[model samples]
Target: MIIVPASADTERGRPGTTQQFADMQAYNDQMLRAGVFVDGQGLHPTSRGARVTWADGEWSVTDGPFAEAKELIAGFTIIEVSSREEAIEWLKKWPASCAPDPGQHLELRQVYAPEDFGEEFTAELREREEQMREEAARAAARG
Candidate 1:
């Protein structure tokens, strides 16, 4: 599985919020048709959220309601691909307007499944997972 992180530039976007959502919807539709993405979602601004961290015998908490757009994490997507090359290919097709500017960035990372741990139980777990996914796919197709 590949994870794609995306953020919107609320400060410098040219097409306005409505247009940005429309563009995102269109991009999602294309991804659905491509059959590579397993799931995706857009997120609310950081102003509505908070962050928590732990230190040496201490807990630190920060309130949201932040105004700095650059520090915000907007949303993410998970894609199932055969290889890194395929993942990169799909990422290259991400909509251009998703970012605030040409330098705006997206981060892609590969997710580790139980099988990656190389434990005896992980083998069985992976087998069961594959079976469940296949069953779910068949069910979706029938519906």
Candidate 2:
């Protein structure tokens, strides 16, 4: 996952400024051509979202408009890649015009897939996942 923090929001939707969108489109095209673009989208401000936390064996929900600008994630992009080095290379090429600082941070995080759990994930579960993969393949073919 690639995380865009505060700076992204500051540069968006201004008049006479469209290079950001074009740069993003170019990056998306490059990633797509490389077969690494799995999914990505920008997020709305914290005012439109909420957080549900589970603690003390109870559920608590907090409304947003969160105070911490640095903590709020502006967006995320998920990619399929062969190695961390490759991911880094891709991120290094990100356009400067897309954020307020003209080269704001983009965080790279490794996501845990079910297979990462090793033996704790039973064979039955693996079989179910394979079936689901097959179903997804079939659905894609239908389209």
Best by TM-score: 2
Tell me the tens digit of each residue's lDDT in model 1 across 1-143. Answer: 33333245432222236766787778778878888767876566565567888999888988775666555556677887888888888777776656544555676788877656677657678889889989999998999
Candidate 1 ranges with C-alpha deviation above 4 Å: 1-16, 65-71, 120-143
Clash pairs detected, candidate 1: none
Estimate TM-scores for all models: 0.66, 0.78
- Looking at model 1, residue 126 earns an lDDT score of 84
lDDT of 2 by residue, 10-118 (tens): 3242212477778888888899999999877877777777889999999999987677766767777888999999999988877666653534467899988888989
Query: What TM value does model 1 have?
Result: 0.66
Worst 10 residues of 1 by lDDT: 6-15
